[model samples]
Target: MDNSTLVKPFKSINRWHMLGWLLVAQVMVAFIGRSLAPLGVLIGQDLALTKAQIGMLPAALFLGQSIASIPAGFIVDRIGSKRLLLYLSFGLGGAFMLMAISSNYFFVLLMVAIGGVGYGTMHPTSNKGILHWFQQKRGTAMGIKQMGVTLGSALSALLLLPLAAAWGWRMALLAACALLMATGVLAYRFYRDPPSAEPHEPERKISWSYLKESIGAMFRHKPLVLLSIAAMGLSGSQLILNTYIVLFAYEQLGLSLLLAGMLLVISEVSGSFGRVAWGIISDTIFKGQRLIVLVYIAALSIGIALMVTQLPEGISFWAIASVVAVFGFCISGFNGIWMNAATELVPFKQAGIASGFTLMVGSWGVIIGPPLFGYIVDLSGDFNYGWFFLSFVLLFVIVLLLWAKRLANKETQHNKGV
Candidate 1:
């Protein structure tokens, strides 16, 4: 009856195979999660939705994730990643597939929110696996795994937009659903926990007090709180790009939908590399430090946000894609480091809870960011103002990171004194 008994035999799988399957799981979920972004224009036109409503599509998905994140973490810590992933994959894929039945805006919104529950499961699940399999190269490991998000997003743009252009958005959703379901089964079959020879411990019973203690400890650690909040800022900026860049390119820059989608693909590809590069930098250049890399990410993101505001109509497509590629590299790529820093603040056993808590907080950014950006664009009748808002948010993030670093230093000193 115990999960330990079931999972024991699977533990012999090489850790690299575990990592590979983890990446596959990541890519599948992300592919489904961001599927709506590239289709926003088509969905909007088909459904007769407003700009704000378009933003709400992705925002609604995030709302569901925020609602489910901590609970999913609890589940992961209890049942273990492989079993949980198998269940959530079905939930996520089925919910997204249901959207194909409705042309009604509210109905589609509801489905996206439901699918988001499944989408939220990946973070804590993958983080738990990484914490278990990787002892020394966590930053690098996390980075490699995190690439699934960007790679998946790029693939959605590369594959889904063209498919949608030819058949329809609903058809594209069906294709994504098939891939997700298959990936889930394959991952369950192949991905394994570290061998029981590696000092594996049984998971604790699901307990409210344990959850309460995790939240309490997270807040009490000021650096962790600040780090979590900074995640909110970065995540909001990332969502804005995911949700709006296609529309922005099509409407403002007068590019065709397919070309605008190409910009998104470029950004995502660059971000994929950035995830791995930032991880290696943290491990080698910063000597396993996280905050300093986060600081650089924040600063660079600010510069890129400012540049996006200045992008003019009639700019060369390659030129615009180049800027977007750089933006993606900074804004989209920083999460692996951010996640590594947040999880390290707590004990290893609590990695799932820590990941869930941080992502729960970050989900708020995803929930609010897109709609707010949409509202600003709707209000000012220009996408630039929306970007200006993100620049300010990132500025606030830099301040939060500095304060977090200072608190972390003080805590280190206090412990030394004790």
Candidate 2:
């Protein structure tokens, strides 16, 4: 067999080296996101944040994400993902450095908010890169790429938490800054706009007409629209699980910090493998069914509910950990499944924008999930309320899925009549 016959990476990563590069880039972004998470409690103490203000950290990121989505999508669609990533990687890294030096919490929060803009760019850039190049095996590639996020989340346990413990959370910010700068350099050299035989093609310059049409098309897209709504629901469920899992294990269940951390590590590690497993299943077993989105949603709903309803009393510590592992596997599966469905919505030309739109839509849950779950805990005086909240949230997702199925049926019938 001729080596020349092997697949080519679209642009800057034409060589076999690109696969390794893409994986590296995704891992870097995910690690940064996950590492910042544990700092929530510490930052709250330093900044004198209330429950509401602490909730604002994730909200700030998601809000900045909402603001950046169209612009980032436009940038990705027009200039390409590489330039955006370049700007973002450096911008976020610098923001981290500033975060290290700031005395006022308001100033520090502003810097973190600025970094959120950069954080917004990662998903679009990674999605565009892998999807364009590995079109046929999209799920496999995205699965591998998304596992970077899972691994990065796992790594934060070992890397960022220890560093924070040893040398203050502020110093940890500086270290993350260094990593972001390094990522920018490598991605600049190695990343490319997922090249097409068609990147810069002539189109009617951006007009109200084009804007109206795109929005109209996206809205008119029954499955895509429904999935967008579903994404928000399931992601909310995930937030409930993640936000309270540690406390649920430690404070609620009386596990030690070491044990809680170990459990999180296991969940994350299993999540990494889970992403890959789900991707393969989506590709081969599901045969690209639009319905798998709901299936995964349903499974996650049940798994999370099981841990909430059963584990506190009946199950041993190891069993609780096992339940968490199962929840991680079931819920995390949606990351790829959702993206894969979004890819099928538009032709390759508009895929970036379409994917970005749905992502921005789904990211709404990231903004909503924590606070909502937190509210329930406050109201009920228990994190178990958080789990019950997630179950109801999943119920909404099932509602959306049934709605999407009806639309899917309608579309099929209309085409048949024609």
Q: Pick the candidate with the highest TM-score.
A: 1
lDDT scores in order: 0.85, 0.68
lDDT of 1 by residue, 1-418 (tens): 4658866676565777788889989998998898888988889888887778899999988888877777886787667888877887998899988887688888899999999889888888998999888877887888788778878888899989999989888888888898899889888887766533235565447687876987788778778889889899999898898788999999998888899999889888887788779999999999877988998998998898889888888888998898899998888888889989988877798786788678777768888888888888988999999889999999999999989888888887988899
Please give the lDDT score for candidate 1: 0.85
Model 1 spans > 4 angstroms off: 1-22, 73-86, 124-145, 182-207, 283-289, 344-354
Cα deviation of 178 in candidate 1 (Å)?
A: 3.5
| Whole-model alpha-carbon lDDT for candidate 2 | 0.68
Backbone clashes per model, in order? 0, 0
lDDT of 1 at 409: 81
**Cα lDDT of model 2 by residue, 128-155, tens digit:** 6675566477766776776677777777
**Candidate 2: Cα lDDT at 203:** 51
